[model samples]
Target: MDRLIQILKDPLLIAALAILVLLGAGELLSPGFARGDQIVRLLTVAAILGIVAAGQNLVVLGGREGIDLSVGAVISLGAVIAGNVMSGNDAAILPAVAAAAGAGFLVGIVNGLGVTVVRIPPLVMTLGMMGVLQGALVVLSRGVPSGNAAPALMAFVNQPFVLGIPGILFVWAAIAVLMAFVLRRTAFGWSIYAIGSNERAAVLTGLAAGRIRTILYGLSGLFAGVTGVCVIGYTGNSFISVGDQYVLPSVIAVVIGGTSLAGGSGSYTGTILGAIALVLLQSVLTTLQMEFWSRQVIFGATLLVLMLLYGRQARLRV
Candidate 1:
């Protein structure tokens, strides 16, 4: 009984259990919904969201009300930039990736400056940055989607590469491993936690809280940009709104994965399970023919409930 109680207290375990329950419900609702191939497909979709949430995770972990409202916008911009750069040429893939990542990083740096140097609240700064990116995308695209994903890019993302798992899953797995290592074993990672847990004390201890937080925002943008590249690859084309749907889901994934909205306590492992659970839930709802707005309502409700249950803690001292 004690062992079981201990497991239940772990957020990662809870998220894993939620995934199982979601999968079971899906199987019951749709006979083949839980089939191996189908689950793999759902996981492929989840991998994309997980990558975006990677950035969100870093930002949220840095505290100071850190949340990147501009991730979706950055993703859209990155996709557009990548699509144009790739132009269906496999040889140009590397260049396209560099361009996408660089653009996103630059934008993220600006956001960090706004939040730290200018003293703008993270919410307002990121929200305004989102608007700015959207406008830039509109002007760049001239109201029409342009550029094609290279055939090889598409295959890399959607086709099985090893052990029948899609290649994108491999990418996500690598990212997950890297994130876990960074958060658990690195000095930078420790600094993030220290700042988030108590910024005033962290600063007094000589940690460069402002600089670290700025880098966190930059990393968030960089991740979003990479996700945009993956998004274009997955869809085989670039659309203005390809990434818009992911904005809220990314944040939700981080929060539900047990990351404190108050900041400083969470794991990428939990986020991974949270991402899977969310994807499974979305798959189940889609199978049930839930309307778009209805699904969004459920997403919002789920986030709110999770916030109350797991994230309603004392705000960190700034």
Candidate 2:
């Protein structure tokens, strides 16, 4: 049964199985569980999470306790800014997107500078950024976000075309392909892995650790910004707490995908599966009418179990 064990140990397989189990549970609890519309909706939600998790994955893959806590905040702020700028106008879509991306990039740069130049701990730096962004959102929106999502965003996020495929799915697919290529085939990608594996060794080997890590943080922000833009399309509006739910979930998705918390190993493909699995779990939980607190407990418990399992495996390997 060595082959069977190996297959079971595969992260993608595990994620797929988790999703299938959840789907089965959902089907038992609710009719039309895998109906066409439900499937499309599930994919849409997962695609958004996958976009955010891509950035989180890059940050953690940079190692040294790298994590971007500000992602949720950036997403909220970006959505707000984009919604205000677009103001339901199709012609303003380009500007709205640019503004959202710029905001996220700025936050990322600040985070990167704090970590690399100021020598602050990444956790503290990102957490501080998160607080700053949250306060900023509250102040700017005055506790309530205004304006509707731009028409272009609505068309892309909520509209379906050609066999009922979501427009957001195409965007997610593009990002996944690009990220997979960069991580697996590019020189800079190799530098990130080397740095995460061992910073000092990477430096000794002529790798630019600080620069690469900084860029990774920036890319993380960019992806988070993209997620924000997608949110406006999907939800049709922005709010102060619009992204509050995503911070922990993004990290959880990355880890569940078999990316070690200790860094140096992961794949976008695995992350995609993890995202899908989490969404399926949520669907099942909702179908069962689980309370919000109960869902939180379950999510937390699941994350804790995964962490322990991966931690043990890493130690064993060492």
Candidate 3:
């Protein structure tokens, strides 16, 4: 009984259970809610969001009000560049994807420099960066992005392998495993947590807090870049505002996964489940044929309630 209670008390497990319950309820309202194929499809969509949230998770763990507001813009820019560069050609795929990721890395470096060297607050710096990317994308694309998603890119992301699991799922799993190992078993990861938990103390103890933070931001940007390519693949095209839908949801997923907004503590495992839950929520909403505005309201309200619940839980644990 004690073990069961402890399991129930775990926020990540609770979130997963909630997803199951919602699926059950959805099944009652609509048949085939939990069909195997549907679940796979749902997970595939969630995997993209999860990939983006992974980066956000790292930044949150970097502490000092660390948050990457430019992710959506980065995604947009990456997709635009990839689309233009690839032009639907299989031959151009690798180089185009590489270019997109490289651009994202550059953006990440700039963001890191702004926060670490210029001493700007993360929120302000990233927001300014977001606006800059958005404007720059407009100028570069001249308002309309050309070219379709490369066939090769789409096929690779959508490919099925190893007992019918999606290639994208494998990609997400690899990233999740890598991040979990880094956070749990690495000196750098330890420094990240230490700095986030207490920056002054960490610095005094000889942790390179600034360098770690810069690296975290760079990783976040890299993930955003990959997410952009996924978005383009899924949609078969790129356009302005292509990634705007992800910004808030990525944050929500991280928070719902039990990552403290104040930073210092989080888990990629929790975030994976959180991403699943959010995607399931979207499926439920869509099943009900809810309007877009209603979905947004519910999303916001749900996030608030989850925050309150977890906040109270944290206090009780303390």
Candidate 4:
């Protein structure tokens, strides 16, 4: 009983329980909502969010009010870049991916510089970066149709690859493992936590807190870019607004997964479960035939409640 209680005390475990409850509610309401195929589909969607949230997790973990509001813009631009580079050709997929990742990385580096060097607040820096990227997208796209995703790429993302799981899920799983190792077993990861937990102390202890936080922002951009490529694969096309919907949800997933907004402590594993729970909640809401605006209201309420609960604790820690 004690062991069980201990497990239940863990936020990750709590998130998992929430996922199961959401699943149950979804199944009860929609009958086939929890069926194998349906669950797989939902997991696939969650994988994309999870990937984006991975970057968000890193930024939040790096502390000092770290966040990458430009992620959505980065994703949108990455998709546009990938689609144009690929031009519906399977052979061009690799090049397209490289272009997207590279572009996103450059953008992220700029964001990092603005935050660390220019002394801009993270929220302001990233938000401004988001606007810049959006404008760049407008100039590049010029109100024309975007390019199509290669059929092969689409298949890889949507079709079952191993044991009936989408290939994107495999990608997400690999990222999760890599993230776990980096956070648990790396000096860089330790520095992130230290800096986030107490930046002044970490700086005094010889950690280059600014540099590490900058890298965190860069990685966030990289992940957002990758998500953009994946988004095109899943949708078979690209648009300027393809990534607009992910920004808030990515933050929500990170927080829901138990990552403190104040930074210094959290795990990608929790974010993964949080992503799943969020997807399930959305699915359940959709099943109930809720209007789009109404669903947004619910999401807003959820975020508000989570902030009150988690944010309070985080503030106390500081």
Ranked candidates (lDDT, high to low): 1, 4, 3, 2
Error of 3 at 216 (Å): 0.7
Candidate 3 at residue 225, lDDT? 91
Candidate of highest TM-score: 1
Runs off by more than 4 Å, candidate 4: 1-9, 312-318
| Candidate with the larger TM-score of 1 and 4 | 1
Compared with the true structure, what per-residue lDDT tens digits does model 4 show for residues 171-267?
A: 9999999999999999988888899888888989999877998889889999999999999999988988789889988998998888888889888
Candidate 4 weakest lDDT stretch, 10 residues? 309-318
Each model's Cα RMSD: 1.2, 1.8, 2.6, 1.7
lDDT of 4: 0.89
Q: Residue-wise lDDT of candidate 3 within 146-189, one digit each (tens)?
A: 56788877876776656877778888999999999999999988
lDDT of predicted model 3: 0.86
Query: Which candidate, 3 or 4, has the higher lDDT?
Result: 4
Cα-based TM-score, every candidate: 0.97, 0.96, 0.93, 0.96
In model 1, where do residues sit more than 4 Å from their true spots? 1-6
Total backbone collisions for each predicted model: 0, 0, 0, 0
| Model 3 misplacement above 4 A | 1-7, 311-318
Residue lDDT tens for model 2, 147-168: 6787777878877955678789
Error of 2 at 291 (Å): 1.5
Question: Which regions of candidate 2 are displaced past 4 Å?
Answer: 311-318
Best by lDDT: 1
**Least well predicted 10-residue stretch by lDDT in candidate 1:** 309-318
Instruction: In candidate 2, list every pair of residues with a backbone clash.
Output: none
